[model samples]
Target chain A: MTVMTTAPDKRDNAPILSVRDLKVHFPIPGKGLFAKDRPLKAVDGVDFDLYPGETLGVVGESGCGKSTLGRAILQLIAPSGGQVAWLGKNIVGIPHRDMQPLRRDLQIIFQDPLASLNPRMTIGEIIAEPLVTHKPELGKDEIKTRVKRMMARVGLLPQMINRYPHEFSGGQCQRIGIARAMILEPKLIVCDEPVSALDVSIQAQIVNLLQELQREFDLSLIFISHDLSIVRHICHRIMVLYLGNVMELADRDSIYANPKHPYTKALISAVPIPDPEIERNKERIVLTGDLPSPLSPPSGCVFRTRCPFAQEKCATDVPTIDRVSETQEVACHFHNSI
Target chain B: MMNKSEKTALLQSASAAKEIEGRSLWRDARIRLFRNKAAVGSMIILGIITLLAIIAPLLSPYAYDQIDWGYIQEGPNWENGHIFGTDGNGRDLFIRVLYGARVSLAVGLLATAVSLIIGVTYGAIAGYFGGKIDSIMMRFVDVLYSLPFMFFVIMLMVVFGRNIFLIFVALGAVEWLTMARIVRGQTLSLRRREFIEAAHATGVSNFKIIFRHVIPNVLGPVIVYMTLTIPQVILTESFLSFLGLGVQEPLTSWGVLISEGAKVIEASTWMLIYPAVFLALTLFCFNFIGDGLRDALDPKDR
Candidate 1:
């Protein structure tokens, strides 16, 4: 994959969000009284730092804990273990009441646009909800003015505010979701596959809208998606996930240009190039097996079961994330060789 | 100071705003309800019945309990001015049936209102916060559900003494169980919907989320169940009256009239027919209205 250049890398300031060893495990009940219940490790020991005004893209196949990680960062889903530090303060385990004020700074955009919006609420009310919660001091007229302005900012007609979400198209509903998330002028916004539900044409539009808003608001965005092509454009850095673990995390150019992990290679190889000549000539690494279930993941390196170069040693030993360069981290034992 | 294009834009948005302003869920449902012929007809009939119930004394010359020994067990006759004729005791049947309407309708509405308040709050809180609290709350509901309804009402009547207000409390206390169950079931499904999750992400309080988000979403089912419950409540009231444990003399209900009517069907058929017709009509109207509301509020239909 050719490198899609982004804005100049700036790491002058402290990180806005830091996630360390974040694990979300759900307990599945046992069959009988004597049987011990097993915990489904959906996200196990993941770590990342999100700088202010940077977009971190998380890429993974279905059920690989991409959405779970995004939700955990925003405290939307409780992480069974680990720390989610927002602006250097650990926000994990904070009661929901205390979490409310923090929510004004941290917001999320969901995958299903229409589902994210309340069907009963008018577009105006949906967008104004965050304002209603956080800015109680703001009068009704002030909130309405802010909502209408936000609506216009997100490319929705201010007049259409009175219309229900059902009346709007998928793209428009997504804009409303964006408007709601952006209403509080949050420092960080989690875009959890915000464009996966839209048409191909609308996907570009929404992605462009997000990029523009990220720049305008100077917002740190966690863009989570399975679509590598779209992620390459929007994300400054990309994290490849397989079976609830990070296979690789690197600067976008380096990850695309020189993908170290076999899992990352297989994922990038799947993205179809727009040019037929390059598409046909490009080498595609097709893995053999499906993603292992998170319930009882492979004991060693989570990706080893599906890794093309899996050895007997790979089954017994977990490959910790090894930093290959200043801008890249790969979690594979033989990343140097293959 | 606005440009021509800006002025046009303002005018256009202003006009466009008007078209969609009143298109709320209730407004749409009302429109759909009116479109349903049966529901509309039922509404008109129910309205007129409620109106007549309110002004029955003013309309009728003979008092509801007035006894004219001269016309005992009389059949319908224009000369005596008893349009619906006289009951076994020579009291006007028309006036009694209308007065009964006041009692029966009030009980149905007020009891349902009571159940609605308790049931919706109980069920929404239980479902929205699921797990231990939900399990315990629902188990409590199960305990209540197991309490034999007749026995409970009888106990209440025995302890508190049978009065019009006690009937409302007894019926409402029991009726809310099913309403809570229906609401809980709906809330269980709705709690998982992305919108509810979105509300949580927005930092809306748990209290606000339950009332603003959960309850409104479950209202479609709650409303349908309520219509069905009213007739059920009315029937229970009649059953209690039949057992001679409800609504003492002087103050009458549809149930009391119906029970009295049942005993003397062979003698004066008007006593039975008048109140029975009114009760059946009211029940049918409620059923038809419920059907209309179910159709109107159904997301599937939309």
Candidate 2:
């Protein structure tokens, strides 16, 4: 009953969250008064619609703004530009005081689980904090009962409530983080590499627990991670990002079976196959140059610097996202030929 | 019925386990502090000194300010019951030194408490908020920092009139600047920490985050600074008293005793020796305690 439901059949219903052309450009500090200010475009012009209960995996390499995009979506880091609409209401540029009531439905889980939990606070206090903030009317006994129950659901012993975060192991700490996020019963949770810090075996457990919770709560998730294999396992739709731009957006099966973008193709191929025979025979496309500096990105296609099939035209013309199929979108000028 | 009994038994055992106090970071630091011989020894010595200061009036027969012209400039002689002997004015140095301890210790503790309150709140807010608010707040700190230490204290004394409480307010106001700077620097690094970010994401108000999250995390350094600040505040008070801007004549401080002792040191050296020894011992104890706290509270060392 807790198994992940991968169906994208909920298109008939309205999207719970809509992010249109979201941009988070961080301005660099200039040396002198006359010096031109350079802005690092962390999440450049990202657009996505998340239906209820759908998980959108944002895949990228290190420093590709996957985490920034996730944070921007939840308004943890304010968006420099664009609209983040929650139930057709624009949440961008809203004062934090106003954002408080809306935050009950929007939550986040961090990458480093242990780092996310405060060292001074006990597990009970940490989990109960959200409840204490949002639901002031709740009795102390009621909050404790809810926290203890949430702790149990997240696989942490309720008896360990008085223990500090440092007393718990990494996996248990992550459970505490999950318990805190879940206590609010948030409608949309931006899971920013939730299981990346855990061991492979532990990652499966955390991922499984997330799926179970999602099903139970009917929650939508924006799962951000660099690991494609884990993203493929849980995410219903995957969005491939490179240097703060989406290279491809496709359904999970379509992304794995037939990735259209050159960057996505390289990324998918890099994932190690389980079987030795297939792994040895599979062709690998290893791009040569390092990730271009986002400070001064390439003029046209951001990927053209490290692209395998780059041409003169690739440098001169920026490629807009083209709908190649009903389930897939590729951002490459020569995607059809290639 | 069996399940109910088992659940109760489990809860009872858990409660019993909880009786052994949880080993928090503060508790861990305390254990480490006791393990350091110098710190624990200093603590005992400081405790003795404080006790003596508190009960000085009860212990001594002669009043702190009583003049005995019969035994003027007398050396350490128990025959007259002045163990530390008498000064030029024939005032018993023993009673004077104990009374001095009272003033010095009071100034040290009260002034440090004042600084801690102002510095921690000001620094934590500046660091947590950042941006334009941080710039403006820190600039104000910088402006305050530029004032000459002696000049500022002298001005404050002139304006507020000379009193022990005024001295406390003056020293605290001056010293809290450095503390605020230290706290602000600490808070800057802590600002980027994931827990602070987590708190923000959890919809905690900025004010609440500063108090509950930021202030507690910065306390290790703040506490260590506080221990060190006590000694500094004591010395500053002594310097002020030496200049005759501090405590008035009837109520003498270590500085007053030392200043009077310096004037007559050629004739009677114990007058200088006794008060000097007490002041030095107290400063040393505070320094050692501060060192111990730094070692204990430092997470890197752990």
Q: What is each candidate's DockQ, to 2 decimals?
A: 0.49, 0.43
Per-residue alpha-carbon lDDT of candidate 1 for residues A115-216, written as tens digits (9 for 90 to 100) = 888877888888989999888999999998898888767777677778888788899899999999999999999998999999988898788778778878
Residue B63 of candidate 1: its Cα lDDT? Answer: 93
With candidate 2 superimposed using the best TM-score fit, by how many Å does residue A128's alpha carbon deviate from the native?
0.8
Q: Which docking band does candidate 1 fall into?
A: acceptable
**Least lDDT summed over 10 consecutive residues: which range in candidate 2 chain A?**
A1-10
Candidate 1 off by > 4 Å: A1-5, B1-22, B299-302
TM-score of chain B of 1: 0.92
Each prediction's whole-model lDDT (CA): 0.87, 0.89
Error of 2 at B262 (Å): 1.4
Candidate 1 lDDT score relative to the true structure: 0.87
Question: Per-residue lDDT tens digits of candidate 2, residues A173-229?
Answer: 988999999999999999999998999888987898898899899989999998888
Among the candidates, what TM-score does chain A have in each?
A: 0.97, 0.97
